[model samples]
Target: MNIYSWNVNGIRAIQKKGFVEWVLKEDPDILCVQETKAQIEQLEEKLTQIDGYKSYFFSAEKKGYSGVAVYTKIEPLNIRNMDIKEFDFEGRYMELEYKDFNLINCYFPNSQSEGKRLDYKLRFNTAIMKRCNELVDLGKNIILCGDLNVAHREIDLTNPKKNEKNPGYLPEERDWMTKFLECGYIDTFRYLQPEETKYSWWSYRFKSREKNIGWRIDYHIVNESFVNNIEDAVILNDVMGSDHCPVVLRVSVE
Candidate 1:
């Protein structure tokens, strides 16, 4: 099965730029998107009725800010909104439970300019990690994907040395990822291609994408039990609609 994840920045904006056509062409078994930035009522029927897929959307209580969505060829056995008051109100997390596994599509909180939101982002990281562990203890395999809003290693972003103080690459944020991996979550792309220097998200300023100066903040992280099932994990750098491109993970699931 093929699953894809992307942070579209703004769903309506991307839709007008041929996102719907691109989705039909790629035809992933499941597609998860972050930063939808719009309520369900604001979406046109074309996006809501994308041929063969059944789409689910979660919009933030504060309209047009932060939201997430999942489009799947197979209807989920169950769908869950994480409902943690501090996190859920922003519409950042959603879960689709199949018979054998659970898929989580998340848009982690970003530490905004001047580190104003750093504390909130850190709290979010801690809470989600706790939730992941709980799911694992329940004997559920998890495939977690979306824009984590972090660049976990020196190799993850261009000029990491120069961006050390930046929100995405800060020492504390990177350590959380290290701890998460140590606790049995595998970073799919890094596990599949350890030495590749590819990125998913680029800055709109400074002609970053043109120069390939970008950060691999988006990811498909799976539980250790699902590692062997992963056929390949890739960064689709050429596929562009937002500052962030799409990340695809292929697996041998039934």
Candidate 2:
């Protein structure tokens, strides 16, 4: 099935910028959205018209803040909002359990402009990884997607040297990502296109998108067991609704 993920920045803003049309064109069987920044009530009228998909949204308690949503063609057996103690308050994770696997959409904490939130981000990462391991131990396949907000390697960002001290490229952040991958998860896109310099997120400043100076912070990571079934992993670099573009993965399942 074709599964896609995008951090829309703000669902309302993108919906005005033809996000609906873009979704129709892509025709993914499932779409996971991060940074929605709006509650279901606010998007009721606009998204209700989208056909052939069942939608589930988890909004932060704080208005206009972090949130996530999932739209799927196949009806999920169960949809759950992760209660990761401190992290769940921001509505960062939503999981859909199908007959064969669990699909998780997450909007990881951004360290913020001053790096004051780095500690919290790290803690969240640890907790989430633990949660993922718990699921994998159950022998169920896992598809984890969203704006992980960290550049895994120097190659994942435009200028690694200059960005060493940057929030997303900081050594601590990158190390956490390494730990995640080492825990038997496959970074799907990198697995398929290792030499490609493509990126999913761009800075809104300095004409980053125009120059293609960006970071590959978003991802679709699956457990190692499903690696052989991965058909294609792609970045929709041409599409624009937010500073981030969409990342997609197609995998085969019996």
Candidate 3:
């Protein structure tokens, strides 16, 4: 199955940029979306009603803020808005449970440029890791995808030396990622292409995208048990709409 994830920035804004048309063209078996920034009720019918997919959305209580959605060609056996009340308020987490495994779409909290939200972002990383571990303990294979909001290594960002103190590249955040991965989740892209230096999110300033000075914050992470099932992991750098691009994971579950 081909599963893709993108942080669309704003669902409404991207819809105007032909997001629906793009979806139809790519036609992933499942498309997990993050940063939707709109409630289902606020969306126009055309935005919600793509022809061949079942769409599910979770919106933040705050209007035009953080949110997520999933458009799947295969209907899931069950879909859940995560039960973590603290983090769920922002609509940052959702999961689709299928016959073989669970696919989690998450939009991790960004540690603001000023570092004011750094603590919160770290807590979120810890919490989400715990949640994933719980599922793994139950023997459920997982595919976790979204903008994780951190650059775990020097290779993940364009200029690691300059970004060392940056919120997304802070030592603490990177360490947290190390701990998380040690818990048996594989960074699919790195697993497939360890020396690759591509990125997923680019700064909207200084012609960052054009120069390709970006960070690999978005990911398609899979539980170690399913690592052998992944056929390919890729960054769709050519696509545009959000500051982030889509990361695709092709896996064999059948």
Candidate 4:
């Protein structure tokens, strides 16, 4: 199965920039989207009615904010949103249960400059870890993907030293990620290409993409036991509609 994930920034904006055409061409078995920034009612039929796929979306009550979606060729047994009210209010999480595993597409909250939203983001981080543990306790393997909003290690972003105190690269956030992985989840891209220095998201300012000064904050993470099922993990920098590019996880799972 080829499962893909991308942070579209704004679904509406991308639609006008060849998003539909790109989806048609890639045709992944499942596509997980983050930062949809649109409510269900606002979505054009072209997006929801994409051929051979069933689409599910979770939008923020505030509208045009944080949101997520899943377009799958294989129907899920059920779809779910994180029940935690504080986080759910922002439409940050979704779980799609299939026979083989649970797929989670999440758009983590940005901490912002000077750690403005740091407290809230940290709380959400804890909640996600708990959720992952709950599923594991129930004997479910998970394929978690999306923009996590943190660079786990210095190698994950350009000039890590210069970005040390930045929100995405903050000590607290990086420590949380380390703790998350240590709890039995594996980062697919890092597991497959340990030495690769590719990035997924770039800044719109300072011509970041042109200079390749980007961060590997987006990911396809899975339970350690499911790691063997992955055939390849890739950062599809060539495919773009937003500041972030799509990530591909080729795995031998239903």
Candidate 5:
């Protein structure tokens, strides 16, 4: 099964950039998108009615702000939000329970300049980790993927030294990621290609994409028990629509 995750930045905005066409061509078994920035009613039929894929959208209470979606050729057995009111209102997290595993698509809130929202972001991180552990304790495999809004290590970004005090690369954010991975979850891309420097998200300023000045913030993280089934994890920097490209996880379901 080929599962792809992307931070589309904005669903309507990307539609003008051939987002639908790209989806048809790439044809992943499952596509989890973050930062949809649109409600179901606000979208046109074309986006909601893509061929051969059933789409599920959970939009934020706020208009055109934070939202997430999943387009799957294989319909999930169950779909649910994390149900934590503070986090739920942002439309950040969802669970697509398949026969054997739960697929979570999440958009971590950006800890704005000088870590203004660092406390809130850290709480969200802890909540997610707790949810993952609870499922794992029940023998559930998890495929957690999306824009984590973090670059776990120095190698995950282009200029780690320059970005050390920045929002996404703050020491607190990196420490949480380290702690998350230590709690029975695996960062698939790093686990698969330890030394590769490919990135999924780039800054729109300073010709960042052109200069390859980017950070690998988007990810496909799975539980350690699911590692054996993870065939490959990749940062699809070649594909583009938003500031972030797609991260792919290929696995064997059978």
Candidate 6:
């Protein structure tokens, strides 16, 4: 199966940039989007009628804020807006259960400028991790993908020294990722292309994207039990709808 994740920045904006056309061309079995930044009512009517997929959207109560949506060729057996306490307000997670596994589309909190929201982000991460572990315990193979908003390692960004104290690069945020990995999740892209210095997110500041100075903050992480079934994981750095490019993963399943 071909599963893809992209932080569209804003669904409306990307629609104007030919997102629909791109979706048809890629033809993924499932596509998960984050940071939609629009309510369902505000979305164009055409968006609800994509040709071959069943689309599910979850928007924040607050207008024009964080949101996530998932479109799949195979309709989920069940779809749920995760009820994790303290983390539901932002509309950051959507969980879908297929016949064999669970797919989670996440838009993790960005700590924001001046480290102002770090505490909230940390707490949010902890809650989600707990929820994910519960699903793992249920014997469901999980595919958790999103813009996690952390650079993860020195190789994940262009200039590690300069970004050492930055919000997403901070030790606390990076360590949270370490904890996730320790809990039996595999960072699929890194597992497939360990030495490549590729990236998925670029700053709009100072022509960062044109210069290829970016960070690999987005990911496709799966439970370790499914690691051998992963066929390929990649960053579509050449895509141009948003500052963040799409990450794709292919898995084999009988």
Q: How many residue pairs clash in each candidate?
A: 0, 0, 0, 0, 0, 0
Q: Is candidate 3 or candidate 5 better by TM-score?
A: 5
Per-residue lDDT over 72-110 for candidate 3, one digit per residue giving the tens place of the 0 to 100 score:
989999988778787899999998999888989999998
Off by over 4 Å in 6: none
Report, for every candidate in turn, its global Cα lDDT versus the true structure: 0.94, 0.90, 0.92, 0.94, 0.94, 0.92
Output the worst ten-in-a-row residue range by lDDT, candidate 1. Answer: 109-118
> Model 4, 24-67: lDDT tens per residue?
98899999999999999998999888988899999998989999
What is residue 111's positional error in candidate 5, in angstroms? 0.6
Q: What are the per-residue Cα lDDT tens digits for candidate 2 across 1-254?
A: 99999999999999999988788878989999999999788885657457878888899988899999988999999888776667779999999998777999999998876677999999989887887899999998899999999989878989999988878988889899898999899999999988888999998999999999999999999999978889999999999889999999999876
Worst 10 residues of 2 by lDDT: 44-53
Q: Summing lDDT over every window of 10 consecutive residues in candidate 6, give the lowest-scoring window.
A: 81-90
Report the CA-based lDDT of candidate 3 relative to the real structure.
Answer: 0.92
Assess every candidate by TM-score.
Answer: 0.98, 0.97, 0.98, 0.98, 0.99, 0.98
Encode model 6's per-residue lDDT on 1-254: one tens digit a residue: 99999999999999999999999999999999999999898988788668999899999888899899998999999988778656667899999998767999999998987779999999888977887899999998899999999999999999999998898999899999999999999999899999899999999999999999999999999999989889999899999999999999999887
State residue 200's C-alpha deviation in candidate 4, in Å.
0.3
- For residue 191, give model 4's deviation from the true position in Å: 0.6
- Assess candidate 1 and give its lDDT: 0.94
User: What tens digits encode model 1's per-residue C-alpha lDDT throughout 1-254?
Assistant: 99999999999999999999999999999999999999999999999999999999998999888999999999999999887898899999999998768999999998886778989999988888888899999999999999999999988999989988888988888998999999999999999899999999999999999999999999999999989999999899999889999999999877
